[model samples]
Target: MFLSRCPLSHTRSGTAGSEAPATGETSLGDSLGTFRRQQDILTPAELAGMSVDIVGAGALGGAILLCLCKMGFGITNTLTVTDFDRCEAHNLPTQWFRPSDVLMDQAKVDALAEMVGWVCDRPITTACDRFRGDESRRLGPVVILAVDSLRERQLIWNNLRNREDVQLLVDARMGAEVLEIHCLDPRPSRRGTTRPAGPGTREFYEESLARPDEAFQEPCTHRGILYTTLGAAALVGSILRAHAREEDYPRHLVFDFRNFILLAHGEGHGETQF
Candidate 1:
């Protein structure tokens, strides 16, 4: 079930000022009212109280976070991001780090928070440490797992699969022009029920996991492409939008950008090519 929208008061970052508006100029509130067109799909008010935790600050994670920010998500509740890696020169092409961030030797989560703050007023919480599935603190209801390696995915899933607090888990995997997304509901299935709550059944997701060595390793230079990363982020945004709208969405989706083909299953099922 989706959360209900309520009255909320939010201050847009960089919009606060004592100066009055010049003649014929738009007010700060008017300028920040950019979501009217999308109000039918989702309004900023609906996202006010939602909390989200995003693991990893690499290509997919960085892009996804930016997308959420632009959509006015996590405005009332801060978005939490955890990552141990620092921004490097190589992350410029596919990730969201700027050259200045690399020169400053900023941690990925910190850099992402700073960058996001510039465009969005929403607050972000950063953890400059790795997530090992054994944190003392509780995670938000929504978790987006974008860490590298199948082992990390397996470990994190094992920790969250049975947790009642975690309602939605979105996992994104990418390799060059190929991208896969899994939107799983971690709540346990009802008693004596044969079907799982979401499309990402434990059995199906577990089958996708394997040893690190068993997975194909993309060459360093071809590991991430800017367009592919953005595409994956867009898909992730669509899933969030569906949830906000209380509509059905694909539980699992795979996209091959090179061939312009998409394969999706669960609530929405289809195979199409352009």
Candidate 2:
């Protein structure tokens, strides 16, 4: 729900059978008028100057992209999307795509960028190759990892953790029964200290490697568009909340889709592994 506002504040309210005043038709001398007022509600200037590099344009990544674009994030945010996968027939039910988009001669990132370009107008930079090579890496103030592979997560953690400029990193694992959100605030010092700060330095990585891979299966055997969408919405909210606030929120959160429970970690937490 939107915030309630007094109509006397130069914002005209429509009567029972009358239409609201259109833009440029308002007698008020306000430059932005109501639009600026709404922009004040949740201005995305914090995300304006930052370049956001996203990996894995699958269900989770696609949802995040839509929310970010609708939030009025600048196109110049240097959007770099990389995905080697293509949209399949089965993906049409769970992932964001159209029948017309099916079997297109393009990668997932390319197809998504094309769809988003209609809203953003500016073309987004897309890479068809997997985000594996050193040259394929990009150091941004914020990096989003929505990939499904454990090895890929380890690689990204190793490459981006020690950078002094990178402020935040977020990872989401939306499984069938549970949705896990992992966040990391890259700083030299934090609550936990298992390792020294430097390149290839992450205590969480060492721990995760010692353990076996955690097995998971989809909750609903067939893709449920509803659950996928709901999880996506929750993930996007967390991302925007982190950016809008002056400080970070939690380092980890989990949502049990079966029981409908949401859990968050305490503050001062360090980097976390999958």
Put down candidate 2 lDDT per residue, 131-206, tens digits, no spaces.
6524434455666777876667777666565566566666676666677666556544542542343212345433
Each candidate's TM vs. the true structure? Answer: 0.83, 0.71
Show pairs that collide, candidate 2: 176-219
The candidate that achieves the highest TM-score relative to the unseen native structure: 1
Instruction: Report the lDDT tens digits of candidate 1 across residue range 79-104.
Output: 77888788899889888878997897
